[model samples]
Target: MAESNKHLPRLLCLHGGGTSAMIFKIQTRRLQWALRSTFKFVFVDGPFTSGAGPGVLPAFAGCDPYFRWLNPESQTAEQDQRRVRQLLSKVIKDDGGEFVGVLGFSQGARLTAGLLADQEEQNAAEGMPNWKFGVMLCGSFPPLSLSFAKMPSTKPSQGTDEHGETREPDEDEIIHVPSVLVRGTLDPHGEKGRRLVKYFDPETAIAMVFKMGHHLPGAAGDTTSDKGDTQKIVDAILKVYADHLPYEELKAPKTTVMENRNGQLSA
Candidate 1:
């Protein structure tokens, strides 16, 4: 590895539903290439396989094997949550460094949002690493019943109660981490993406809209290969890291991280 990339901060890259890490990697090749110098992207396959599910992306039509972070048919929300937490923990341990950030598309983005929210509610003693920021590309918010949905608000709100006296509302749960939400104007899930953004603090979240469809576009209106769009995404990712994590932390060694089915960590 080049000296500049030797200590580059690691970012967990989550693939969309019905798309494996390998597939997503290819899908976002240009963007990833542009960002490789500044960040080490770790792409992981989701736990559930997409078996003839309705509404799966057309690109996965004959892919034979596809994956997802959550499977409503075979797993409950709690089970899926535990699986994600374990996978992240194992990856961090295997890498010999903590994940500075996360970048996800579609279902993966949704999972990332949920994870960040969950981290907000956790006690420091739990030993989970707090991600500095996240990039959610076409992601959605998890159900309110999840732990991330319970994050207590640190900011005060100014509003009048039923009594007509001005006062701050009770501390409500909110994800405090800064996030960049990327949405395609033509995507059917665009509305869901908007709803997810509303869950975060208005001041901390940034929403970027592209002119294309469901997938991560390379240019303003091009879904596949637009150098300009790729650079924009790359810039957005780097900015989030720069605004949050220390520069010194970005220069950490890369190591092998893996987890067994039992959730035991090993390198």
Candidate 2:
């Protein structure tokens, strides 16, 4: 952590299942390089150690250490959330900095979404940080047990009908923060990702898609001889901070505005 970076807005980075902060740092090296000067990233390891399961072997092949936010079979969603809350409390207490946003991939993304949903209901609770933005890569809706589905919708219906009968309000769970959702066109979780993005208020959420697979694409995987896909991810995140975050001094990098197309903006 550089002394200069200490003054920049901080982003809490969460890794996916079967991955550690180290692995995720390696995976997003390109994006970090691009945004290093603008944002300070704090990568945290998950609470649960990797266990024997499908994809765990290949995902952690030589990676002696790996982690997950929770193990569904062994722990309940509430237990996992409590652990997350404790970890975040410690981070905020010891880091002496406020987190402006969060960036997560895969399983980590699911946890991020869940935490935001929880914060909507628990903002007044002690030791919780109110994140201004979130960037979810290949994320899905948290499981029903996580209670995100049970959160009350923040957007109420407009005026009453002609007969003075108030229209029923839309009952969708809303995440009140600027968010960037990145998904891969070829990823098997594409449908789930779309569902999760739809859960948020469309006006505040930006959906971006690439032609790659499940993995986060970076400079090492670039073959187009142009700006790598990770650059686009970084750009989207910076845009969210610039347009919505309450940081007066942070300037958004000049770039083309991304439009949502077919539920996703191309990278």
Candidate 3:
């Protein structure tokens, strides 16, 4: 028989900082299974190698060769956004699929927010495709505007803040895309996640605050409630998908399916 769900819309999966695509795939295995009929999840690695991130050890130990999307110590925010733009362009071009949305955790979540901002404020003018939605899980920090102005040489830190402890989003940075923003109550970045919510249009945003740390729902030593929490996220994603993309268009064979690209660890 022919593939049953060949027309499922694609949703890109971006791993958190200090993690690899393989690890994220493993981390989100249950979630993928939950949404298997609704979406085809594509996992990709970040470009920069780095040490493991918070809440990654003791369980995901030996899962070496971790990676990050940006290195604040070396690259300016402007430089990092450029690299991220190139990385995304390459991924989208290579997949050749209908990218309906993206799902990201932690640092990846921050990048997802920035990706939405850039798509709206910059890339759309260049004919780049727009994601129908975004899913940010345990995200921290406000996103860097890809169109940030050049910093003056005399005051190199004029337009960006590498360590923005309580940074706020500018009016133009408020994303209008439908999004599911997940937050863990016990996470250190929980407050930041709250701040991040203001960066999205409240009308199109869904906030899910759970009682856990800075990790995906049902990850590691999560409680029995994990399954329920995970289901909430799944429901939210489905709702966003339904609200953003029309059912007929989602069923369109020309754009819903990927070309020859199998979901792999693309960097």
Q: lDDT of all predictions, in order shown?
A: 0.64, 0.68, 0.73
Candidate 3, residues 27-102: lDDT per residue as tens digits? 8987888888888888888878999988788788998899988775865766765666677668877877777898
> In candidate 3, residue 110 scores what lDDT?
84
TM-score of each: 0.73, 0.78, 0.81
Top candidate (TM-score): 3
Which of candidates 1 and 3 is the stronger one according to lDDT?
Answer: 3
**Where does candidate 2 stray beyond 4 Å?**
52-60, 122-125, 143-172, 219-226, 245-248, 253-267
lDDT (tens digit, per residue) of candidate 1 on 1-267: 445565777888888877788877777777667777777778888777876332444655676588877766853565665666676667777876556787888878887776676667673213346788888987754412224334323344355344222332233446778777877667777777766776677566656766656777652245443446555666666665666656675532222222345322233
Stretches off by above 4 angstroms in model 3 are 1-6, 124-128, 148-163, 224-226, 247-267
Error of 2 at 220 (Å): 5.2
Number of the top candidate by lDDT? Answer: 3
For candidate 2, the per-residue lDDT at 267 reads 30
lDDT for model 1, please.
0.64
lDDT of 2 by residue, 88-177 (tens): 667767777878888888888877786676666564224756778888988765412234234322345456443222333234456767
